[model samples]
Target chain A: MLPTSKSCILCETEARKIYAAIFGGEIPLAVLNRFVVATQRLNANVPPAETDAYYRALLACDDLEALEVAARYTRKLPLLTRKFRLMAYLAETVPETQDFFINDRSNLLAGLWAAFTGGLRTAVKLPAGLWLLRRCAHV
Target chain B: MSELIIVGSGAAGAAAALALADLGLRPLLLDVGHTDPGAGPRVEGNLYDYRRRHDTFGLYIGEDLHGLSDVLTGETGIAKLNAPNAAFVVQDAARLSPVEASGFDAIQSFALGGLGNAWGAGLYRFVDADLAGFPLRAADLAPYFDRLTGEVGISGAGDDLTPFFGATAGLQPPLRLSYNADRFYRSYAHRRAAFLAQGIQVGRPRLGVLSQPRDGRPGCDYSNTEFWQDAPYLYTPAVTLRKLIAAGQIDYRPGVLVRSWTETAAGVVVDATDAATGAALRFEGRTLLLAAGAIGTSKIVLRSFRDYDTALGLLENPAVQIPFVLPASIGRRLDAQAFGLTQLNLVWESPDHGRLQGSLLELTSPMRAEFFMRFPLAARANLALVRSLLPAMLLMQLFYPGAAQPPAQLSLREDGTLRIRGHENAISVRELAPLLGLMRSAGLWTAPMLIFKPATGHAIHYAGTLPMTESPARYQCDPTGKLAGAEHVYIADSASFTALPAKNMSFGMMANAMRIAEAAARR
Candidate 1:
C-alpha cells in the first residue's frame, strides 16, 4: 500500500549492504566506497572530520533517521557542502529505502523548512526529507 | 567660512561634494545620516545567510504568497538604508508631516546616502534626445559623465546602446549575463537585423558596479546578496563617500535635518533641527547646494517661501513590471554569478510615438520562489511542485519615457511642515499589450498575475518639481540651478530635472548635481 512499491528493489538491497557495512564493518564496503566516491563530486570544502562524523551518525541510526542526523551535522558545513552531502546521501541510498521517507508531504515540508530556515541558499539542502525537522526546532 | 554647503549625504550629495573637493574645495555637508547599526547575523563565509534565513522563515512559511511581494517592496526597505518615510532608523509618526496622496505614495529615505543607498545602480547616460528640454545640452554634461563613470567604475561594454547611451572611456567589463538573459541576447542576436529594423534594440545594461576588482574593494563575488544586504563591494554611495572622507576631501555631518534657508548679505543661512536632540541649529555658507532628493529638496524650498506656497511639477515615469518565462530555460538549475540590478536593457522607439525602455532583471535565486506565491491558493499548497517554476521566470520592467507626468504640488502647512499632493498614473494592460507582444515575438511568454500594477513612486524616478527654465518667474530654478527667489541657494538634486526619461535617474541625478556644484564653485 506504500507509495514506495513502484521503486527499484535493488535500492533496498544496496541500502542494506551500506547500512550493514557502516555498523557491522563486515560487508563488501560497497556502499561506503560509493559514498567516498560521491564526496569527490562535492563542490564544498568539507573537512575530513565532518565527513567522518556524517558516516558515523548513519551507522548509529536507520536510513531516514541517519538523513535527519546528517542534516543537523550540515549546520557546521558551508552551504555548498550541506547541499552536496544531503543530495549525495539520498542518491546513494536504496530507492525503496529512499521512498520510505521521501513522500510528497516530506518533499513539500523540506522545501518549506529550507526556505524558512535560510532562503533559496538554505533551501538548496532540501532535495530529500532530511532537512524537514529543523523547522520544528525554530518553533 | 566654507565656500559651499550641501544638503543630503546620499548619491547626489556625495557626488556634488566629491566634484567640489576635486577642485580642492571641501564643502560642508549636512544629513540625518541614519546609520542602522548591527550587520544582521553572519554565517561563516556567507555574511548575509543569517538575515535571509530568519526573514524567509518568519515571513514566507504558510503565509499567503500574495503578501510576499509587499513584504519585499513595501514592508521593509528593499535597499539597506532607504526605509520608506523613515527619518533614519525610527519612523516617528508624530515628527514627520504626512503628504496627502491618491493613487500612489512617495517614500522618502532620510538616511545618509539618501535613496542612493537603495538605488539599482543602473548607470545609463542620457543622450540629447533623453535630455530634450534641459538647460544644458548632452555635450555640456559629457565630461562630468566621463569623470563620474571613471570614479564609480561602471561595468558595461560598448555595444549597440553606445550611440544612444554614449561612449565612456573607463568601464569595467560587464558581468556575465544570467542564463535567461544570455539566452535572450543570443536569440535577439541571431535575428539582430530584423529587430533593429523594428526599432527595438537589445544590449547589456551599463551598471554602476565593478566587474573586476578596483580600488581596495573586491570585485563582485557573485553572492546574490545585492537586494537583501549591503554588498559594499558593489558601488554604493557609502563606498565613494567613505574614501572621500578618509582623504579629508569632504566634511560630512550626520543627524542634521535642514528645515529652511535664507539668503543674506554675506552668505546663505541654513536653519536645521538636530534629530539626536530637539535643539535648533544654524549654519552659514557662501553657497548653498540642495541635493536633498526631489521631494526633500522641494519641501525645503517651499518651507523657505513663507510668504507664499506654490505648486511645482512632479515629473515621474509611469512604470510596469512584465514577467515572462523563457520556455528553453525553464526548470534549469540555478548558478552562482554576479547578479546585478539589471542584466540587459530593451529599448523601443518610434518617430511618430516615443521611447519605452525595459530594464530586464532575471530572478535566479529563491527570490524567484516569491513570485510563485502569487499563484492561485490551490497551486501554492504544493511548495515542492511550485518551486520548480523558479528558474524559468524573468521580470522585465517597462518604463514609458514620454508619458504625461502628473504634477505633485508642495504647499506649506500652518504647522510649519510642507505638504505634497500628487496622483500616480494607473497601469493598464491595454496600454502594455504592444510591449508584451514584442516580448512574445522574442519567444518570451507570460502567464496570469505576471504583469502587476506598480504603485505610484514605485518606479522611484521622481523629478521636475523645481525644474530649470529660461523664465525664472515660471519655474523654481534657472539654468545655473539657482532657486528663483533665493540668491545664494541652488537646487542640485533631481528636483531641478525638467524631464525624467525611462532610464534609471541616479546617474543623471549624480552627474547633474556635479554639474550644478561645479558651476556654483566657479561662480
Candidate 2:
C-alpha cells in the first residue's frame, strides 16, 4: 500500500485540484506535500485491495469536473477518511484558507456574510455534487 | 536512611514533602516521573496569528496526528490530553498501571507532576458544606490553604464566590477575560438579583496561575497556548518538587514504580520496581506516606493486603458541558490578549440537588479541527461554520457533587489488575433546565443538541477510594490519616477523603496532605 513516486505525484495533483475546488485557491506545494504524506501514513494499514480501488477511481479522473466528481465520491467512502483530514489541514495551514474561514470574519457583518455565502454555496452544490459523484465513481 | 518515604510526586506528595522539609526533615519521594520530551517547536505569538503564519501543526496537533484521530473517530470530551507536547503527562500510564473498567473511562498519570501537569488550574478551597462527610472541617484546612496561596501564587477577585471558595490571604489580580466571557459576566451582574433568587452566583475563578512574575516564573503571557505547551507560571507539582530538590530538602527519585509496602517491626519497607528495568527494589523508612493519588494508592493498599474481594468505593464528579454563543460577539474581532484558562466560576445551591459548580471557558485555545470534523456537514461547510462561530463560542462545564453520583466500585483481581465498574449518574435535561433558563435570562443562548455529557471519570477528580472515618475499618484510615491495619503508614492523598465536593479537589488534597505530614512528623 506504500505510495510510489509516480503515484505520489498523481496524489499531489489530485489533492491540489480538490483543495482548490473546495477552498477557491491553490494550496502551497509544501503544505500539499505534508497533507499527502500524512494521508499516505494514515491509510498505510488499509487493505491493499481497498487502496488500489480508490487509486483506480482517483486515477481515472482526467478533467476538473471528473476530478471534482471523484472527490465527492471519495468523501463518502469510509476508506478515504484521509480526504476530510486533508481538507482540515489545509484550512488550518494555508493562509488563503485561513482568511476565508477565520481572519476575514473580524466583524459581525463580515461573519454573517461569510456564513450566508458559505451556507448558500453548500446548499446549491450538494445535490448536484452527489448525483455526479455516484455516476462518476460507480460506487 | 531517610526518615520518611513518600510514594508519588503529585500534588499531595509535593505538599507533604514541603511541609516535612519545613519541620527539618527530608523525605524520599519515589515516582515513575514521566516528563515532557520537549521535542516540539514552540509558538511565539497568539495561536490564531501563528496558525495564519506557519504550517506548524506538529506543535499543537502532534506530528503523528494524535489529536486528529479523536476527531476522525468521533471521540468528544477534553482535548488537552491529546495535545502533542502534553502527551507525556499521561504517557506509560496504561501499560504500567493497567485498569479493567466496565463503564468507567479511567485516566491516570504517572508523570513527575502526575495529572496536575494538564490540570485546568482551578484552585478553590472546600467550605464546611463541601466537607460534609469528612472528619474535619473547613477551619482545619484553612491555614494550609493560605500558606499554599503564598507558596504558589493564586489569581482571583473576592466577589460572590468568596462565601463558597473562602478567602485566601494573598491572591493576585484575576486574568483578563475574553469578549464572550466578559459579556456574560456583565450580563449576569446586571441581572444579579434575578440569578440570586434562583440560588446562583458568579465570580472570577481562583486559579493557581501567576498574574505577576514571582519566584523566577513569568506572568501569564496570554498567548492562548495553555493546552499546547507548559507555562512556567502555571503551578504543577513538579515545579515544587524541582525546587525542593534544588534546595536539597528532599530526595526525589524518578523512574520508580511503587508496587506495595510491608511494615516491619523495625520500620516500613516499600517494595517498588525500577521503571527502566524489571528488577524489584526495596527501601525502609520510619514513616511511609501513600500519596500516589486516589487510584494509585488504592491499588497499592489492596495489593499489599492481598485482598481481592473487598470493593472500595470510588467517587467522581458527573459533568455536563453546554456550548453557547453570545450573539453580540459573533462578528467582533478575536481577543488577542486573552488567557485560555477558565474565566468565571458558577456556584448554584439547588434545594433539590444541593450544590452545583460550573466554569465558563471561551473556546479559543484548542484547534478548530478538533471540532470541525465532528460537525455533520461536509468538510468545507463544517470548516466555514466553525470559523464563523469561533469568535462567539463559550463552553460551560457544569459539575455535579460527587457525593450525589451513583457509587462506582474499585476492586483488585487475582491477576494484578484493578477493575472499575462504573455506574452512570448523569444529570438529566430536567435537572439542567433551570440553569439553562437562568443563562437565557442573562442572554446566553444554547440548544439541547449542543449539550455534551461525557462518560463517567472524565471529570478526573477521583477520591474516597479508602475513606477516613471516626472508627476506621479494614480499608479505612483514621482522621489523622493513619491506616487502620498498618503501622507508621499514612494515607496522605484524596484516597482518604471522606466525601468529594463539586469544586476542584487539588487544593484540598494538598492541604490535607500537609496536615497529615505535620501530624506524622510529631510521631
Candidate 3:
C-alpha cells in the first residue's frame, strides 16, 4: 500500500494537516472554503454527482495515488481556469508521487522549472517560454 | 598492432579509455553491455495509470521481501542498508562471476559500465596520508583527480571535509540537503566545538552528481529516483563512454566478456566468449589493461597464470551502520528535499585508532522500507507507525581503516576456477560504546547498534590484490600498474591499489587507471 499523508515523508505539511482534519470528521478549512467558493462560482448549479465524486476522490487520496487522481480529473478545467500541469509538477517533485511523474524529459523540464520557480507557482511562464523556443527552433 | 585492450568498461576502464583516447592512443573497450533498458516508471499514459502500473513501493514489498529476509537472517552477509536494489538497475546475472561461497559475496556486473551502474555516486580522493606507502603519492595523483572532477562534474561544498576528502575545486553546486540532513548538519554545526573535542568533524560529502545542468544532461531534479533509476543525468561510466564513442575516440565493442589472456612476444592475445551467442573470440593488443574490478581482474590473472595456484589478499574496510533519531522531527510531516544518497560526511581522528570517517545518509524515502524493516520492531505496529519513525531516522556508516584486518584470499583451484574465501572481521559491542556515546553527546538519540561484519567482498571496496610496490614481487605490480613477470600486461583497477583506506575507492581507482594508461601510452 502507498504511504498515507500521516506516514508519507514527502507529503506537504499543510496537505497532511488537511488530511488529518478530514479524517477526524472535521471539514478542512481550506478545502471547505475552496468548496464554498467553488459553489459560489457555480451559482448553485453544482453537479451534485460530479461534486460528490470529486470530494470522495480527494478525501480517498491520502497518498500519491489520491494526489494523481485529484490532479487528473481537475486537469480539464475551463480555459479561464488553471490547468493541472501544476499538480504534474507536484507529482514529479514530491517524493510521494510515482517515478513516472519524474522520469520523462517533459516532466524533468517541468521539474527543473519548478525547482527554479519555487515549486510550480511559476510553471506557466517557464513552459510557455520553452514552448515558444521549441516552436521557433523548428521554424 | 592493435593499440590497447580494456577488459571491463567500468569506472576504471572508462577513465583509462577516455584518457588514452585524449593522448592519441586507440583503446578497444570490450564489455558485456547488456541491453537491459532501464525499467523505470514508463512516461506513457497519465499519472494515475503510471502510478498503478509502476507502484515501486508495492513492487519492492513483493520482490524484495526475500532479500530483506536474507539480510535480517545474516544470509546476504552485507548490511541491509548498503545492499543495492539490483532489480531496479536491470543487472544481467548470467554474464557475471558465479562464485557462491559462504562468508563471501563478490558481485560483478558484465553490463556496459560493469558494476558502476550501481555506484552510489559518492566520489572521494585519497589524501597524502591515505596513500602514504603507495608507489604513486597523492602529489602525483592530484592532477588526475582535478581532471576527473572536471570531467565527471562533482557536486560538493568546500567545508571541513576539504582537507581529508580532497578534490574540492571545480565542483558543481551541491543539491539542497534534505530536511532531516539539514537538521543534523545544523546540530553538528552548533556543537562543532564539542564535536571537535570528541574527535568528530561534520561536512558535506563530495558526490559525482551534477547540481546544475551540464553537457546536455539535466541537473539532479531531486526526484529521489537516484537509488533505483539511473536518471541518465547521473555520471555513470556509460555516460563518459557514450561521449567517447560519440567523439569517435573509443573503439567500443559490446557483448564480449574477456575470459583470459596470454602474453606473447608481439602482443597479448585476449580470449573471450560472446555473452549472447557463446561464440569464442580472440583479440590481440599491444598492451592489455585489466580493470574488471579487483575480484574479476584477479580471476583473469589467475586463469592466465595457469602455472601456479596462488592465493592473493583482497582488502576492504570494516564498516558498521549506526542508526540515530532526531528528537525534533519525530512524528512530524517532513519533506524529503535534495537527493536521497549520502549527503554529509563526518570525519574525525581517534587517539587510539587513526583516521575514522562516517558517511551520514538520510533514510527518508518511502521506497526505503527494505532498510527500515531491519529495525526489530514490535510485530503489532501498523505501517503508519513504522513509517512515522522514518523521518527522524538517519544512518551513520562508520568506515574504519581498511588495513586493520587480514585481507580476503583469492585463489585458483585445480580446475582453473577462481575462488575467494574471506571471513568477516568482528567488531565487539564494547568497542561501539564510545561511538554511541559520542553521538549522544552531540544531542542525537542513538539507537541500539546492529553490528555485523560485512561479508568478505560485501562492501565492494576491496582492493590491493595485485598491489603496487617499489620493486616487483610475486602477485605485485609496478608503480605504473605493470605486472611483475608479465611485461605486456598491466593492471588498471582497484587490484593495483597499494593501500585501501576507509574511503570510497571509485574515484581513486579511476584516477590510477588513467595514470596507468597514460604511463603505458608513453611506453
- Highest lDDT among the candidates is held by which one? 2
Docking class of 3: incorrect
Candidate 1: true contacts recovered, fraction? 0.00
True contacts preserved, each candidate? Answer: 0.00, 0.38, 0.01
Candidate 1 residue-wise lDDT, A1-139, digit = tens: 1112244243344345344422232323433344333333331234555534544443343433224433544553232223322222332222232221122222334444533433442234343324433432232
lDDT minimum window of 10 residues, candidate 1 chain B: B58-67
Q: If you assessed candidate 2 against the hidden native complex, which CAPRI class would it receive?
A: acceptable
Chain B vs. true chain B: TM-score per candidate: 0.90, 0.97, 0.91
Please give, for residues A1-139, the per-residue lDDT of candidate 2 as tens digits.
3475557876686577656655657777766876676666555656677667666545544333333333444554444435555556545755545664564436788667756776675665566555555654674
Cα misplacement distance, residue B467 of candidate 1 (Å)? 0.7
**Looking at model 3, how many pairs of residues clash?**
1
Instruction: Write candidate 2's Cα lDDT for B386-486 as tens digits.
Output: 77766778889988888666768999998878999997656786677778898988878888877888788888989998889999988899998999999
Q: Per-prediction TM-score, please?
A: 0.74, 0.91, 0.74
Top candidate (DockQ): 2
In model 3 chain B, where is the ten-residue run with the lowest total lDDT? B376-385
Fold similarity of candidate 1's chain A to the true chain A, as a TM-score:
0.29
Per-residue CA lDDT of candidate 1, range B11-110, in tens?
8898898899889998999888776453342222331233233323211111222212233222322322332212233333226535654454566767
